[model samples]
Target: MNREPNAQLIAVMDEAQVSNKGLAKRLRDAAEQRGMNLGTSHVGVQRWRDGAGIKPETAALMAEVLSTKLNRRITPSDLGFFSQLTPATPPAPPSVGYPSTVSDALSALNGLAEEPPKGPDAGRLIVPDAELSSAVLSWMISRPDGVQADQPASQRVGMRDVHAIRAAAETFMQLDFKFGGGHGHKALRYYFRYEVLPLLNATFSEQVGTALFGAASEISQLLAWSAYDSGNHRLAHQYLTSTLRLSQVTDDRMFGARILSNLSHQANYLGNHAQAINLARAAIEGAKGKATPRAMSMYSAMEARALSNIGDHKGAGRAMNEAERYFERAESSSDPEWLSYFDSAELMGEFCHCFRDLKQRRESVQYAQRAVDDTDPRYVRTLGFCRMVLAQSQLLNGEVEAAVATAGLAVEGGESLQSSRFQRYVTDFQAEVSAYASNPAAAAFNEQVRDALARLDDE
Candidate 1:
């Protein structure tokens, strides 16, 4: 029978007289010393015992912490199976659950790391297709016709039409969230080009035109976002360029900031971490005092997320702190309807993800728990992501059993949501769990997650 180094872990635990809570407290304290705020809870430590290993870099940190506590050099091999682990394959569509939505699609695009393709591999991009460019131009030319030309130039277009388009775009956004971008983007693109653009072209007062442009710009950005989500990065990039042009024409600073945020997201997805950070900072600086509190908060959160990806832990934490403050400020300040998504919970969730990437396991778990606790039921996708982060944090802490349990919950929640990003999280967690294949519980969990992922392939 193959045995792990559990004996060493137990010896250290006993010598240190460390209860699970004690170990968690030590981990939290160590993290705090490194400028990470984390919570100490028994559940957090239980995850470590369950064989949920940390990221390799984080495992190194944990080794350092253990060495200090035990007064001996601790290697990841002493933690059992963690040092040898590798990242896992991404889950398939069927396992992801639910219909693809624009957000789900975008998440899929963002999750691609240029790593080896997994599952069916049909959706992965290998080479840019010229056909997508032609499709975009064709869609752009099919704008809706209007009788506005027959009317006096001043009376040609009306606010009611702008409102109607806004309403339609909002509906499409919702649909895109539920059904993948592939299902809703074409219709929205068609609507914007045909109906909305023609209206913009018709004669209208400066004030009315500005409002119309804002609505049109937002719809265009959403179209771009949807395209990005659907794995059509080239098309998405083209749409974003168009949206930026529209924002510039309108001189809408807020819209410009929003487009910049999308660009930051794209940069991050493409592994251009430095470019992503620069773009996010540009968005924040450009908005300056002009952005509503909610918008500013959202921008700061984006900055923190990008910083985390680039291994700027201190900067990322500071950005998260600033974002939290902005979120608090927004509570007393009424915000634009479009900016309502900015909230403390959302920011914390984003921060947790950053911590996960940085391998700050204790901090990741703390923030993830807070996010899960504070999130609304309707934000199932966010909640699922939070759970996945928590599970990963747990795994990193050396709690195989707890990691498996937490990962199971994450997988179940993600599978129910039909989010490719969430499924990728599950895949990563499975990869982490594979470190302890020698553990019966860990092996069982791995098999279960694998099976779940395989089912996704069928869909």
Candidate 2:
């Protein structure tokens, strides 16, 4: 029967010499600056005064605004009993139910990519521990046992053992990309704990030990990225932390930068844009002259993506320009295999996405067209992303028919890709189509997308 504290809110209003309406206006202004539209009416203020508590996220925002306005840190707890109010909402059902395999979890995530945001309720989704344990066990069961050497004990262990470890790591990477992280992560972790760790612990020459360190670091990174792709952020962060330590053991600066880039991508997707930008910047700085040109370009591209999300259009464009220059320079030579996957077309496609997010329709359309024309058929996911941007641009330009057509193509292209991230881009585009739910053309397109996604889910 404890009442909510109205004292803190009242004190802040009195100190600022502002009425509730004035405070609401200021709060709205601050939220708008950060790309949120918060409409707090005078009635809402009165409700707070009457002991009705705000949602946790809204309360956090209020704390942020008060801290900025008062030039001091202000936590929700300062508001008294309201801070103690737990979320009334129940937790969301797990994406995959009990007894799910790694493959099942991945498929479920891919299916979820098509679901529209269920509002604040979406945050309730929890990944269960049983799902994680099952995935790891499946991966471990799938790996072949280590082969014993036939050669004499002296020269038997030189280059052959290293080659075998590297081959296993490469296979795991392919599995991760094709099947998603959940399927391969357990096996990768098993390899690290049983094989890689033992090899590192054994005495060897400096060169052999360095080679072993590199192999371990690569496996660690694959495991971390897989955990991330599977929506296990906390586990992913833990894996990445270990990967960083392994990379340091080998002085593998480039690999460390790559891991940081992936971390930045996770941060951006989680809506922590400021942290994303900072992590990306740290990655770029860490690479310096040690990383290859292609690596630098990739890092720059990551930074641009983070900046765009944070509403820094000018900085994003500048970073994109630099990324293009590096990509051009690398494309001229026989690019390394690792860097070969990212080309001018791919970078331009990503640039189109950045422009679309910033609402520069003309720029988005231009780059999307270029990307569409140049993309390879094997990269259907990239094509889908580019087409989605084009559809967005078309929608903004009032070309409803054209937007629907473009979105149709995007959906078709997305159906072929295994990437949940790519599927999400198309789903978001479909949601925009839903904005025109009354328009016959848009409604038709929306229905088509819904049907397509439903089929995908069934599969």
Candidate 3:
């Protein structure tokens, strides 16, 4: 522990564009994904940077995630880590990679949230495939977390505290809808760590506790989406897993299904085709007879995406039909606030992406147009995604000029939106259209995308 700065580590991180804290988080996430209970924070990273050695195993894990990201083989030595920084610890217990108790869940959350001892924890993140499925399966069938009530009230908490939390969550939701997830995650994480966590561990009645879990789950859901939109997939997975456990503990089946549907969405994006399918089905089955029409519709919509990814065209069509049918049955008054986003425009957006994957350009354009036309202006990010789908559909139809025009609109709208995935759509569009670069229209579109993205990155 000479505490001498490890210049080699600094050079590697600088080259990789990873902050010290981001590297710290990626390691803990990698360990958790592999079902290890070990944790690492920015402080350890600071120590390593200060000439402290890293555990060989931790260094290897760090190399793994980083290597995979950079599309190359990385070694512990490449990261300037110590030849050995492993801690002496008990062996990892045999279990799926997910928390089984409040303490475990909290530990997982803290691992995700903690930063390098000296710097802000920041980065684009993602959910790992094994971890997503493992967490989803456990929440579906696992025993209760046995969160006990406070025998003697340690702190006086009333409906006022509960209401305050709910209101804060709603405000964050509105901010996310109006601006983008990036605009809210930092604030959301801060609130969760300070305002909310203390109350979670404080004393309360059964009614209060029930309300608290539900409220907290909703807020956590917001954080999950915020992370996803921000391009932190593994971190998003962590949040979803934590929230799903809380939903089950609260016996909030409806919310549980919602969490699963969100997981499916992320899974499909990450190409975890089978996991996406299973998660969607689990949502439907776990919430059977309990999910509102809107909720079920969203779940089916996710299944459609999974099916499309796996080349199950027929299954995708059936799932799409099921989603439409469920939407038709949804009642406004009976729907929860969370499910309200799954409206007509949202359903059409789902259809747009499904048909795009199925190579049915006409249908894709049809639904995409509808989604773009109908989605509320308040939901800026959703609208941006729909436009990207429409742009892609236009390309599939050989309408390059129209596609570029639509894509321009998406980029314009995207400026006000704060989502890394949304930016991904921009890049995906560029790559897809670039293949047609021989076409004059396509060449022009390429220039537009190059310019648009430069501006977006500057933001």
Best-matching candidate per lDDT? 3
Stretches off by above 4 angstroms in model 2 are 1-158, 164-198, 202-205, 331-336, 416-418
Ten contiguous residues minimizing lDDT sum, candidate 3:
116-125
Q: All models: lDDT?
A: 0.61, 0.61, 0.74
What's the C-alpha lDDT at position 36 in model 2? 67
Per-residue lDDT of model 2, residues 120-231, tens digit only? 2211123344543343233223332122224233332355677778889778766654444556666676666666655554556656666766676666677667666555
* lDDT over C-alpha atoms for residue 135 of model 2: 30
Candidates 1 and 3 compared by TM-score, better number: 3
Q: Which window of ten consecutive residues has the lowest lDDT sum in model 1?
A: 90-99
TM-score, prediction 2: 0.63
Q: What would the per-residue lDDT of candidate 3 be over residues 1-459, giving only the tens digit for each residue?
A: 245466556766776788878988887887777566556888887777777765445665676666555543344544554423211221222133667777676666555555312211122123445665677778778776544676565685667898899899889998997677778888888888778766878887778888887787888889888887776665677688777878877778899999888888876775556778988999999988988888888999999988875557789999999998998998999987666677899899988888887767689899999999999988888899999999988977878889988988888877767776786677666655654445687667667766776776687
lDDT of 3: 0.74
Q: Which regions of candidate 1 are displaced past 4 Å?
A: 1-155, 178-183, 331-333, 416-419, 440-459
Q: What is the alpha-carbon lDDT of model 1 when measured against the actual structure? A: 0.61
Q: What is the lDDT of candidate 2?
A: 0.61
TM-score of each: 0.64, 0.63, 0.74
Kindly report the root-mean-square deviation of model 1 from the true structure over all alpha carbons: 13.3
